[model samples]
Target: MAARAGIASSSTTLSPRVAQGGSNIRGEQRGKKRKSPCLSMPLFRSPLSRMLVSPRIQLPGIRLRSPLVGHRKSPYAERRMLHIDLNMEVEEENADAEERGLDSGIDQVHQENAQNCFDADDDVPVALEDEETGVDPGQENIQPWFDPFFDSDVDDVVPVPQENTRKNVVPDNDKRRAIFDAMLVKARKGYLKGHESKEVSAQFSVPVRTVQRIWKKGKSCLDQGIPVDVESGRSRCGRKKMVVDVSRLEDSSILSRTTIQDVATQLGVSTSKVYRMKKEGAIKRVSSSFDPHLTDQNKIDRLRWCLEMLDPRSVPHNPVFKPLFDYIFIDEKWFNITRKTVRYYVAPTAARCIRTIQNKNFIPKIMILTALARPRFDSDGNCTFDGKIGCFPFVTHTAAKRSSVNRPAGTIEMKPIESITKEVIRNVMIEKVLPAVRAKWPREDAGKPIYIQQDNARPHIAPDDRMFCEAAKQDGFNIKLVCQPANSPDLNVLDLGFFNSIQSIQYKSASTTTEELVAAVDRAFEDYPVRRSNKIFLSLHACMREIIEVLGGNSYDLPHIKKGVLERQGLLPLQLRCNAKSVNAAILSLRTMADT
Candidate 1:
């Protein structure tokens, strides 16, 4: 009865499980007599702790044990039971306090501790006491430990720094820029099917923010049956132009401002603005070379020359032009050993090429006399004759006078002719020029007299030079020497572009000696494409029209006729049609002057 009193009095001291109607013993074991209710009750047992029971019933993830069997209860056992009951009462009171604290929503320290205990499974431990020792269980009222975080004043934590890396992205292809935008829209609609932004971005190799923007733009596009398009920006929304009245720059009075910077300063605009104007064809870049100061006699001579070039059969109506294929252009040019400046591409680790010369003026140079006629082509466009008569250099081979690093004494060496006199020109025409004309002239044109055109340089032999006239009547051939107006280089095919073309290729092959320079010039001349030479003749004809338009004044830009396109389409004309009005006006102006 005393044990029964002890068990009943301690009913208020029961744990949460017992107070909530939990039992450790099975229902079948409850009918048997025991020392006290506490004996049948589990000692220091928790729902979290493993419960030992008889083999009759087993709970998953739990340890079961049979009730302890004894003949009688001892005083020590009674005292142990009292101690356990007292601890249970203390724990019950603590649990009630914790619940109250939680309800009040204050005591954040305890709340944080409870949160930690809930987060970590092993935070709150359940200890089982030894039935034999009767040792006092550790702390009964376990108030949750205070969290250090609650005592601080900080709201946000500091984050670790991250490195910002930049990638070198190439510019978008201007040709396919529209296609790229459309692809972006289509990919966003197809690949971003309810997935995260990063997933879609990784799949498409685009930024996450870009993917988000694409999705946001594509939201209502599909539903509304409107095409998804990304607007880059409104046109003309960039930096405003600081200078607007650019027409002032077109005044001829502003001709002194030749460079972009000079024009920019005068107009109070950036140099880039001036460059943009140039790119848009608002202005053009031209060489500052002065035109030939023509006299009255020079103008008359130019007009006469143009009239002679015109076919006499052509009139005011049904005008026909001469083919001019039976004519040859001859000119002299100084071929230098090297250019003043040259550009080369080399590896970063390569050794630099050092070109040493004692003096640029003293550098080796040779005078080359080149002759060419209009190339002949068949109806099928196959070249019949290349019309390259030959190029002769004014050089002679002689034995080396003294020993030098370049060559030993008595070694054969090439030397340039320093003095080019009229006699030298006469001899070259007789010996070298006339022979080439006979050897390469087409058989059909060989029967007709061919005109050799040359510029009016003082060193050039006259048309009636005794030696040249004697050489002209040879092997049943008729060749005449004709001199163009002074300072009218544009009239000849060589000065029109052929010399510049040869120089460009000759400079490509670096030469240190006169011999190498001559060889390089010859190779360049030989390799000069025939079609390019043909184009030069057409350019000569174009220049003649320009001269006639300006009344023999050299103040005209070279006309770009898209000759390459014409040649490719087989529509290139053999001769340009001269404007009949210009022709008649020129003839009338000359005749009127003559009549006066």
Candidate 2:
């Protein structure tokens, strides 16, 4: 058959016959050949083959037939394939289960729980067991249990141990006895020990000197081996004599009556001295009518007038003159460049003999000249510039000596006489004085003649100044020069209003150089207020009126007024308002205006 099949297959003549068991046969003998069990039916013939076969591989355990295979079956091979398919299906199912678990977030939850465990272990530094005596001392232990107020509530009722209480103690009775004994000992000590006083007197019940004396006497008693009987000494005391009767000497006896001069002669004293003694507490005045007390309102008025006279702005009509010039005021003081230093005595100790000499800087005295114009009432009764003007010149003469003794001494050096000369005066008048005056009265155009009033100083009517004045007169200027009483700086309103003000302001400042001194003087001048100048004018006018009133309304007598008369009897000197040069410039300008 095989040969026949082979021949047929080769010849391609009849239909080929099939052979089994890996043999190939070709024949169209329908029932002649046997089939191998491994072979299945053709895939095209099966309806389910489409679901089983693909281009790459077939499904596990699925049978597909070749075209040549007929009904073929291998039981063992089928069983083996079935087993492999089942194994692959079981592996795929397990992998699917694992993937579903991951999607449900079970693995992520486990990971976070593991991290929390690690963090909890790291929070505490040490274990509680390690903090106790279980750990060695040298080994580091992080945790410890401590209580701050472990012994706060101990017993107070129990007597404190020796170590718990303070050591020092004092008995009150012993202290009192010791103080008493000290006082007694002090009473026995001599006055020499008492002289050395201390500041402890305020604290002790007894004097500080007594305490010192007690201490000394206690030491002396101890050294001399003497007993101190404190109680017995305190018990002893002394008494003083008392007067019983008192009598007075009677001056009513007619035969014994004597004149004050006769009594003074008998007593070998001056009559005035006798009267002074009688007026004072020393002796009694015999006559009741011998009233030595004189209420000289004129003197008071004169004094008040003098003060008013010092101020150029003050007039007799003003009521403030009595109070304003009652105190010393200095202004417009000038100092020489050379004499700027002042000497003072400094005490090294409280002892008078231990004084140390030193030089302090003080502003030197300067020549201050000023003017006071009387108030001229206008048609409306307002004060105008038509009244008579008074000029006052004050030379602030500082004592060059260490002592500022008011009395004129032969040894005291005076300021230079030529400092108030025509040249200096003219320069100041033009440069500084005129500008200030013009600034003060810019609106006033007084038709009255201009007058320059001054004291009887040589500079007041200097020959050179007189020649200058003549020259000015030739130019048709109505300049009149008036002289104040000799040595009468107090009468000059300029002396008080302008010059005194300057001196007081610059008194404390010491300028070593001429420029510095001049600057100081200028500063002082600037410090004065314009109202002060007005006050000075008022004061001067008031003084003039007072003087006129004192003279029974005739006129003010300049000659009779003393040069050194105080502006107010016990009051301060009047301060000048502006500089001398300013006053002079005002006068000159007024003169020029009058001439015009």
What's the number of clashes in each of the models?
5, 55
* lDDT per residue (tens digit) for residues 400-441 in model 2: 555445444444443433345656655544444334333332
Model 1, span 64-124: residue lDDT tens:
2124543343322232121123223333533553654422322432344445434466566
Model 2 regions more than 4 Å off: 1-447, 462-466, 470-477, 508-510, 545-596
Instruction: Report lDDT per candidate.
Output: 0.66, 0.40
lDDT of 1 at 255: 65
RMSD of each: 17.3, 41.9
Indicate the TM-score of model 1. Answer: 0.60
Alpha-carbon shift of residue 470 in model 1 (angstroms): 1.8
Candidate maximizing TM-score: 1
TM-scores of the models, in the given order?
Answer: 0.60, 0.28
